[model samples]
Target chain A: MLDNMSLSRHISGQFNAELESIRTHVLAMGGLVEQQLTDALKAMHKQDVDLARRVIKDDHKVNAMEVAIDEACTRIIAKRQPTASDLRLVIAIIKTITDLERIGDVAESIAKVALENFTNKQYNLLVSLEALGQHAARMLHEVLDAFARMDVKAAIRVYQEDDRIDREYEAIIRQLMTYMMEDPRSIPNVLQVMWSARSIERVGDRCQNICEYIIYFVKGKDIRHTSPQEMEIFMDNNR
Target chain B: MLDNMSLSRHISGQFNAELESIRTHVLAMGGLVEQQLTDALKAMHKQDVDLARRVIKDDHKVNAMEVAIDEACTRIIAKRQPTASDLRLVIAIIKTITDLERIGDVAESIAKVALENFTNKQYNLLVSLEALGQHAARMLHEVLDAFARMDVKAAIRVYQEDDRIDREYEAIIRQLMTYMMEDPRSIPNVLQVMWSARSIERVGDRCQNICEYIIYFVKGKDIRHTSPQEMEIFMDNNR
Candidate 1:
């Protein structure tokens, strides 16, 4: 019953055809999330409330994509009963889509932060935040690329990139803290930036999550909660 | 070939048996997560570093439970190839366990906040946090009960409770903001408390997620992103 040729054919045939289509859909959605992140950052840097609102409004489409993709995966599992690697692929897509949707959420949060620029102050912090935003966006794009290719090493690269993001985020937070301590009047504005920075850190975490799911799907290992250095070790040993 | 009686027996017998076992497992995991939250709050309120450390240590077990349940779901999908409501139950369990694990993570975050009790200041905020923690604890317990019974109305009740938690969280944030503005020296401690409160707010979010999944499982409707008032209207019409 476990015919190798038949199994191979099954993988490349109908089940994978559907899987491939879902994969394409997920990648397309990932492209949308990246654009949302970029646009949200642009909105903040330029104080474009209209673009911020657009980012918030576009999140519904991202949310809808998740539901649709999840339904397709469920249908595939019920119908095709994909096993082992194929099953992992489907599950990874499901998990990654959740992260992608959350990325969209983080973008919306940043957009709201953009709307809070009542004083139009702190160009330095805004530039720093833009740098953080660009880094997060690029990391997200890479991780999505890794997922689309099932690239384990690329996933690890994204995993390693998170530490840099974390450091940059904390530095921004420290600067914001100094701002708040010096001028109590800027507390509300600084608080919004701090919250937005927190959201970007969450984006890094989500990107890390997507990377972890990729390795899990490809290698069947759970590397979550591992330190970046330990992740390197684990990947080395597992690979 | 499509024998109704056999299919009926199949639904109520072996498949249901496996389903019951997984449900029990999930509930056991929920109980552990609830204990983790309570212990973390105790650690913070009473300044029990040892207990906080224990909470952090216990998260590994929660993570293990998530992996085990996910594997079981994958096995059931691969072997039983469950359809319709049965399939939705497994998928929802998979989704719910991720939220449960994240709740565990939040508890760990709170425990770490307790460990930050170096100068031992902010007793009032700590007490307020305990009240918020207790409310979140009760909400978590009720949501799990709703989940176990697949009670959509009970789940909706829990969903509605998160708004109260959010309001409480915002009020606390405002109080903390004033503290930071008045006593600049307390910024570090205040920042830790703010982070901890954010984690607790996220716990509320994760609980709301679990409730939504329960309703989705029982009623097969997506009420996420809908306003609470709109949710009530949708539930009444859909129910």
Candidate 2:
């Protein structure tokens, strides 16, 4: 009986090691995705088709990472059958990785928009978009940090910042409308920028989704779509 | 040996019952959310504050349903320790409920916009708006059916129809912009209508997310952010 208990403990330790390995791969994937978004936005601002092409090419890496991480998760779940907190952590990571992978897709969408507008007349409006992209990238980094650390407080802060991206998105839309109304010649170009802004806003939303996963991992509750105020109150009571 | 076998069968039976209950609750929640979107759009068309209020009130019920379903999932996952396909089904249902709840929130946002514009001047643009709403409502209904029935082929059809809502949303935005440009008096009401249209477009996007979840549940592959054509090929090959 003693030997059997010792062997089970050893297996549980191996499962934790496997889970950590998967987490490491996911974080590396997140880093590549963040770079893709950043470079894509910068490419748009500078009208550098080369950087845009790089982003488009890097999506394959993201896709490959997604497949590997997914396979790792499946094997872990099937082999380890982790329970309780371990189970929740694995589940949260699986769902959160999917969201992260989708964020990479949006980044690819932004790169496509940038590439499409490369030959068009450059919009002076791309400057404001740089701001939106920067904010989104910063949020993504913070949310990933929150996820890695399992910091519910940090995740809560990132969730609060989603409204900032929404405000930026609305501002961009109104500005694009103003430009389109002022000059029909700029309509197509502005429309491309609108799609790009929408993509960035989507990235921010997915970052918030990641933060929600962090809350779930740490607190074991889903606080998505609820108001930030309510989240704070609930987090306070729960903690 | 007979008693042990009977106890094991009884536990397995309980697991199946819990799975059925989860499926039933999710479908019921999906129906409630779909109805909220339809009624909110209808209320906007008819300028019926009463209907709008009902949609708003029903959002609370959707929230309650989401909580009930999530708790059920938590209890089932904890008590049953489901493995293999059963584990996947539970995780997929948990994620799908989150998507459904977000759809409910989007409907509430539309209803709130409807209420805001009720006291203001009326716009006759509600006819096209009503058509757009009906299209979206139908799409939601079909997708929900595909989900409940686990009909992957039917779910793929819903995925194909999502573009229709996207095109309608773009057209409405352009029409509203043209109206605002031609007549400043139409700006406020038309803008609210545009906001509602955008919300409806997001609802369509959420439906696509649900379809992706359906594919995940049925096929055990993540097709999200992948090309639809490729997904169709995958479904063919795997099936």
Candidate 3:
């Protein structure tokens, strides 16, 4: 019986090691995806088709990472029968990876848009778009940080920061409308830029989703669809 | 030993039953969200503010259902450590519910835009938009059908139909651009309508996601980001 107990402990340790590996792999994948978005936006702003194509090429790596992460998650779930917080952590990792994979797709979408509109004349839309991209990239980074640290406070901060992105998105839309009204010649490229902004706005929303998962992992609470004020209060009480 | 064996069997049975319940709950939620999208479109085309408000109100139910399904998933994952296909089913349900919930939000967004533009007297943009909505609503319905039936063939139908939505979406954008150019008075309402079209187009894309998930579940293949010809081979081989 003592030998059996030792063997069971050894197996449990193996699972724990695998979980840690999964976490590391996911963060690495997140870093790659975040870089994809940054480079895509920079490509668009600088009108660099080569950089845009590079981002597009990098998407396959993101896709491969997603599949690997997913397989690792499934293996962990099947092999380890983890319970409670351990189970939630694995499941959250699975869900968060899905969001990250989709964010990578958004980056690819932005890159594709940039590629299509590369021949068009430059415009001021990139300024607001760069701001939005920067804000969203920061949110993703913070969420990943929160996950790494299990810092609910940092996750909450990411949640609160989403409003900045929303406001910036709205401002860009308004600015695009005015530009389109003044010069119809800018309509095609302006519309592409608007769609790209919308895509990045969605990227920000997905970041908030990652934050939500972190909160779930930390507190076992379902803060989704709850108001920001209520979330703040809940976070305070839980913390 | 007999009791232990029976207990293990009972737990396994409970796991299977809970998974069935999760699937049923997701289907019900999908039905409600699909209706919300359809009615939101109908409300916009017919200028039915009451119907639009109803869609908005129904959003609360969709949100509640999402929470309920998520809770169910978490409980199952926590209590019963399912294996293999069962694990995939649970994970797919979780991811699919996220997509379904987001679809509900898109429906709500469409309803909000519809309600806000209700005061405008202009109605000319409704022609192509109505067509776009019909196509999108049909695509969503078919995609869900593909999901429920696990019909890889039917899922491929979604990708084939997407080009139709794209064509209609582009046509509507072009028509709206001409309308805005010809008369500034129609700009605001037409823009709102354009926004609605864009939302519907995105809803179609989400339907594509559902189909892709179905393929993954049924055929054990990741069809995402793959070429159409490759997907056809996947469906052909898997079917």
TM-score of each: 0.92, 0.84, 0.90
Q: For each candidate, what's the DockQ? A: 0.56, 0.22, 0.48
lDDT of 3 by residue, B1-239 (tens): 22223223434565667776787798899899889999988887777889989999889899899988988987887688777666766777777888898889888887787676444346657656788888888888888877666676788888678888888899889987777776655656777787778988888888888887876766556677776687667757654
Tens-digit lDDT string for candidate 2 (B1-239): 22223223334576887787788899999989988888888777777789988898888789888878877876776677676666667777877887788889878877787676533334576666787788888989999998777776777788878899999988987886666667555555665676678778877888888887777766677786567688768757644
Candidate 2 deviant stretches above 4 angstroms:
A1-12, A118-122, A167-188, A225-229, A234-239, B1-12, B118-122, B170-174, B177-192, B225-229, B232-239
Clashes of each: 0, 0, 0
User: Considering only chain A, what is the TM-score of each predicted structure?
Assistant: 0.91, 0.89, 0.90
Report the alpha-carbon TM-score of model 2 versus the true structure: 0.84
Collision pairs in model 1: none
RMSD to native for every prediction? 4.0, 5.9, 5.7
| Model 1 RMSD, rounded to 1 decimal | 4.0
User: A1-239, model 3: which lDDT tens digit per residue?
Assistant: 22223223434567878987898899999999989988988887777899999999999999889889888888888888887777778878988988999899998988887777433344567666888888888888888887777777788888878888999899888887877777665666777787888889988889888888887876778789886688768878754
Error of 3 at B68 (Å): 1.1
lDDT per residue for candidate 1 within A81-199, as digits (tens), equals 78877888888888999999999999988888777745646645676798899999999999988877777778888887999999999999998898888888777678878888889
